[model samples]
Target: MSKATKTIHAAMAAHVSSALDALQAAGTLPEGIERGNVTVEPTRDPAHGDLATNAAMVLAKPAKTNPRALAESLAEELRKVDAIDSVEIAGPGFINLRLSDNAWRDELRAIAALGETYGRSTVGEGTRVNVEYVSANPTGPMHMGHCRGAVVGDALAGLLEFAGHDVTREYYVNDAGSQVDTLARSAHLRYREAHGQDIGDIPEGYYPGEYLKPVGEAARERFGDTYLEATESEWLPVFRGFAVERMIELIKADLALLGIEHDLFASEAELQAAGKPEAAEAWLREHDLVYDGELEAPKGKTLDDWEPVELPLFRATRFGDDQDRPIRKSDGSWTYFGADLAYHFQKAENADALIDIWGADHSGTVKRIKAAVAALTEGSGRNVPFDVKLVQMVQLLRDGEPVKMSKRSGQFVTLADVVREVGKDVVRFTMLTRKPDAQMEFDFAKVVEASKDNPVFYVQYAHARIASTLRKATAAGVAPSADGLDRLGEEELALVKVAAQFPRIVESAAAAREPHRIAFYLQDLAAAFHAFWNLGNDRPEMRILVEDDAEITSARLFLAERIGQVVRNGLAILGVEAVDEL
Candidate 1:
């Protein structure tokens, strides 16, 4: 109901809504009918029309009429709009519409007028969202294992911000977990190595990455052999705090390589020290969501040491989980679920919605965490939207062979090294070329290849081509002008039709919380532009820059400039730079 700048599709839907309202007021249709199902989208086949709507089909049954009969009435109302050239009722009461030439020209002007902010929408207005992503444990430098989620989270945050949501980008630091203890032990070995001790062959349980050497060196520099001969208890806390801090610094640097920066780094250690988990548990107990219960052993498998023990359990089964989940261990330590539930509770205190981008490896735990959030929020009489997006691991390949270890990190390929080999834009764009949950292979050779098969290169090439055309036109004594846009033909208008879908794409992508939709949309726009550009191969006049006619040349250049703007806007959302020249 709140109006912002309208996309072509939105505008068409609004027209249908208005027509329905008029029909209701005139007693032709029933009043108080739900119109939620009405939708407008681009027609699949070009021969049919430009846009199609299912308003009649969606509202027909509710209006006490058949679909075809309602479609005829709706088509009559739609045909009266000046922008619609013709309306045709298709199979099953779907109505397709072709727009007048002036309508496409108007959209081109809107693109130029809106410039970089063309695709922005206010549909998510007045909502504040918390987006937590790439909370890789603070035990080591980020590798390919963390790269996909990092990019996906950052891109989704950007997409939501573009769609008019107030977004907080956060990274939850797992400093309280056992992994950081392993990190401290690992750094201790390196610290000894730094102090002229031959600490050979990092032991099996400790981190082996050479990246921790710097942390050890820094520890030695700060403590100056103070803890070299101390007891584990005396030095454990000191080294644990020191190593976690240093690892966070390293993590920040690695994230920077991919153009990601978090607004907050919520620490699990600090959260525990603040007694948030205890508070959450107390609250859950008060609401009867938590109870002391005995749980069965692992399903489908048995351990000789396994025994039923009473623990504080969350009744997650009541909220669609497979079974009740334990919040505490026999030793009275909080489980990962306990700490994560408290963390999400903390996040929900200040945001209207919560989204976490996690690696698919954590897929099993998603249900329990979601159930906890739902229990805490809904039980407190507040409704907070929550979503968990799982990003699959990226299989790094070089020339069709699996890429193994990074000599720098000593375990897996570091994200920084990959970014160094291929630029940040290439890495970021390539990660998004597939859906987040679908398995994918990141081929260094394939991503850098200068061919249509490479989406990153292909989309960039389209923008570069448009830039080149604009420069050539300027050198040829012509400038982009809207004056001659009316002289454009069907081919040029078709490109505009594709570009005009940007606003709709932004809203839908933001609504779905899928940033890859923007990437996919850009690919389609790039393909359309390239196909139009290829027309110049056979007919010289079909080119963007014609030597003889300055009038049409300026018009075409204007069109190209707008397309480049759209590409830039889309790239900006993905944290990929839109290069004027590749």
Candidate 2:
């Protein structure tokens, strides 16, 4: 295999697979055992080896043989590979493989050659994936809750693209629901307020956010009270459209502050107006997936009327949900879920797989939407995967105190506020420092800290240090070259091994839909570089700018440059800028 084709890990996996084939051909192993399930990944404790494989443990049962016996055979065969320094069969049936120090040195050269595209892979094979995220309602500006999903979705899209997937970053604009209607009413009040009516106390059920005050001002400026005197019916439609359009702008601007932009804005109102909801209803009714039924009063919630009514319902229970979900209310207006089902059905027509990054508050609805997709695909005899990633909330803090926010009272901190406080790079990187499903606290004081505890600062500082070293080296009449790179010491080689995990890290994180892995991986890489840099504190011979031996200095400089390149590439996936200077 060539370096241009795949990473070192892929090459190793292929070689081991071929060894298995050779064993089967020589009648030492079974001829037809599944090999795709074989996993060759890094070990947590580096003391074991650089990489470990469960080939024997996985294949033993299928091949009907003793695992240890097969491991001994596999270990014998793997030793013949060129990159393998030694192979040790560890506890149970895991085979640990250590690569030569020269292999680590060569990976540094590969990083230098590949630059920004170092860890990119063809694993996705051009599968068209739609990643819908930050689908905050188009009623007001994005608040603290929207920040995590925004960064996670954007980073996941970039990660998938790096893995060679055709990804579409999308946002589902909920402009058709009752919320938008309420938004229109709120804007009408704002319009009145803009006209000097002194609209006091903003009625009880309407939005009270000051962000809508601008929409009112814009409407007053544009329409000039043309429909202010008109009846509610005449002005409702006009104001609804105007408010949604303005709210879209507000949402987009908030997203732009965090360096996020969507490839498509899917509108629920458009889907309904285009008769898609009706079409979906007709299709479900034809397949008996929908029916007119009276539902039991919903459990775990208190209702005033508590009366059963006949409604059009989707057969959610048939697809493993607890109960059938209603598509339309008794009054014949479409429910929110009805419009959403139609929207998803429309999205499925364009992509092979679909992903939605939603807040954890919507956790209960995940199963129903999944069942809906399953029924839709099964009914149509087409397999399209739909996955929902529930992002837990982030607790905003200041000086170790919780930043309490409420959308109703408009006391919440906006995304723009946080970004303005500590730059877009800090906001994006800090939001992605944890998994999407895990709740994390974002302390304003901690993120901007210059210490190693702040991951963004630490990684950026490492890159800056490397850049400063290289610039000073260049100024002193020394340049980097491939010559004498293998003469590096143990500390340099250890950093090389840690940096080489970038390729595998990208592939794994992309597959798992987790971008936090990149942030953590960069932290580890930065830690390794910092540790290696500290090696020069007491030992002057290990420093990068040695005056007597130019060859050794050039080799060390070349390695440092590639380390910076890896950090830059990793930061790119997270949508964070890699600063050349702290």
- Steric clash pairs (candidate 2): none
lDDT by residue (tens digit), candidate 2, 1-582: 265435668777887898788879877788878887898888878899989999999999988888898899889999998889999999888999999887777787788777888988888999999999999988888888899999999999988999899999999988877888899999999999999997879788899988888888999999998977888899999999999999888889999998898999988888889999999999999999999998888676456758778999999999899999999978898987888888888888889999999999999999999988887876888788989999999998998999887756867899889999999999999888888899899999999999998988999999999999999988999998779897797888888888888888998988888888999999999999998888888988888888898999999999999999889999998899989888
What is candidate 1's lDDT per residue for 1-582, written digit by digit as tens?
Answer: 223344566778788888888888877789899988888888999899999999888988888898998888888888888889999999989999999998888888888888888999888985999999999889888888999999999999999999999999999999998888888899888999999999977787788887888988999999999999998888889999999999899999999999999999999999999999999999999999999999988777577767889999999998999999999989999999999999999999999999999989899999999999999999988889899999998898899999876543367788898999999999999999999999999998998999999999999999999988888877888999999988999999999999999999999999999999999999999999999999999999999889899999999999999999999999999999988787
Compare the candidates by lDDT and give the number of the best one.
Answer: 1
Span of 10 residues, lowest total lDDT, candidate 2: 1-10
Against the hidden true structure, what lDDT does model 1 obtain?
0.91
lDDT of each: 0.91, 0.89
